[model samples]
Target: MSMKTRTVKVGPVMMGGGWPVSIQTMWKSPLAAFSGPGDPSLLAAADEIRRLAALGCDVLRFAVPDETGADSLGALAAASPIPLVADIHFDWRLALRCMDYPIAKIRVNPGNIGARWKVAEVVAKAKDKGVSLRIGVNAGSLPEDLRGMEDRAAACVAAAEREVAAFEELGFQDVVVSMKMNEPGEVERANRLFAAKYDYPLHLGVTEAGPLIAGIARNTAALVPLLKDGIGATIRVSLSDSMESEVIAGREIVACAGIKKAGVRIVSCPRCGRDSFDTHAFLARWSGRLYALKDTLEVAIMGCVVNGPGEARHADIGITGAGDFVLIFIKGEIARRAPLEEADKAFAEELDRLLG
Candidate 1:
């Protein structure tokens, strides 16, 4: 059963309350990259934001290091195609400054933002503006007392609970909570514990999960179980890669966990000695484009036809090498053939036809 937690609205996107799991990614470049004197930088950032949205990134977050960064975020938020989230650290004032803009959400740990009143001030402003707030609690940034706990996952939970209590005290409930740890086991345990204790929607992720492959593996291992139990509302695959890569990884993880039922699905076999087609190169070229498609497509890029057609027979469309030529099959039946050199072009034509 899906965990029906409290729903928080970030602009037009709704998370929890049985909504589909949303994918988020943080902006890698500093806010200053788009905070130049003219509109050029902001326009460039807007283009990047649109591209991420096309790749299925539901929420885009940026770290607000200072007041200037907050101002930059406001400018970007005005033109962003998707909802923007301001990630604030020790300064509650930054969060308040961010609220002055069109930002949809503010992310900060109540414990780290100085005194309780500071948190209250930000919370009050967020409430008045109808903006949601995410209480982020990372294992590495826990309070001093919580850091000495024997169980790190429990420590994460405790920190989050305290922040949630502060929000509750002000009767502010437009909140979401996240507790991330670099270790996959701790991440899973923390999310499970939090889900059991509160109905506040949980944002799932594994912090500092390294590069593309390693990050995907760690986040998948940690998130699959929690998502399977319907514990997460929004997810971000925190990869040390491009924001686009993170969003794509999050989508695939959601699909693999069976938490999502719609979107393009790609199935390709691992190449072996009998392989004729360069499956690796073909996938690397088409993965992003294929995933960006809105239609429900089951595309299979197989190595050889020996078992390719039979193996991916259930696929809507497939391509594989058959000796000297490439074969494009539809529903297990060969639909078209092309020479090795022209395979990509032929596949593109067929793909366009299918998409059309």
Candidate 2:
């Protein structure tokens, strides 16, 4: 059981209050083009957001640097199916401006968002708009006074506490806090301390967590322990990679921690001397579409007949190949066989039939 905190509604999804731990990822492209209400590009962006949502992303955040960014995000928020978050820095006006739209949440560093009154103004606006705020405390951007503190984890906890106090003083309680550090240990330690001190929802993440392989490893190290101990309420696996990859990694982490069992899980074999099938190519062609599935299905793609049916006996669907022929297994039993060149089409037909 996860730590229970106050429930904050983000558009259609609910965070905390024992709700499922949600996944968040940032938007990669420039936001200017998305401001147009019904432009082709804007429509395309909406379509992409829908795809992301289908892949188990509960919240999507975009950086709002200026009024233009606010406009762009506002327009997109009007049509976004999932909740949209505005990441604000320095200027408090942009935070104020972003609330004018249907933006679900605002992420701000109270330490960097200037004097108390400025943060107050932003909080007031957010409260009026039913927009919850995320106190995003990053290790690299601690307040000047606390920068010299030797216990960095404690400093992070203090930073989040200050912000939490600020919000509480103003009678605003819809808050989520994240204390992120590049190091997994610090990330876990800081977040653990904060959760012990407060009941606000915590957003778990290891900031600037490197490339794909290393990032996943570092995040898993920090997050799994907190999650298993019932500490985190929502999570973002920050990566130097695509947003889709980030969302998928976040879901996998949550699942691995036994937080939630949801979405499609893809299992594949690493090719070796005995392998005749191209597992990599097969996954490359099918991974995205498979992850987009709403139903929870275990899918296995193996390099040969040996690892195919036996290892994936419980998989709802399995596919593998050996030389001239390809085989498709349904529940560990061979259901279809096709020539090498025709395998993909044959699998697609069976998949469609299975899904239908």
Best candidate (score: TM-score): 2
Worst 10 residues of 1 by lDDT: 30-39
Q: Go through the candidates in order and give each one's C-alpha lDDT.
A: 0.89, 0.88
Candidate 1 Cα errors over 4 Å, as ranges:
33-38
Which tens-of-lDDT digit does each residue in 268-350 have in candidate 1?
A: 98999998989899999888888778888798889897878775567888998788888898777788989988988998998
Q: Each prediction's TM-score against the native?
A: 0.96, 0.97
Model 2: lowest-lDDT 10 consecutive positions:
29-38
Clash count per candidate: 0, 0
Candidate 2: pairs in clash:
none
lDDT at 26, model 2: 96
- How far is each candidate from the true structure, as Cα RMSD in Å? 1.7, 1.3
Q: List candidate 2 stretches off by more than 4 Å.
A: 33-35
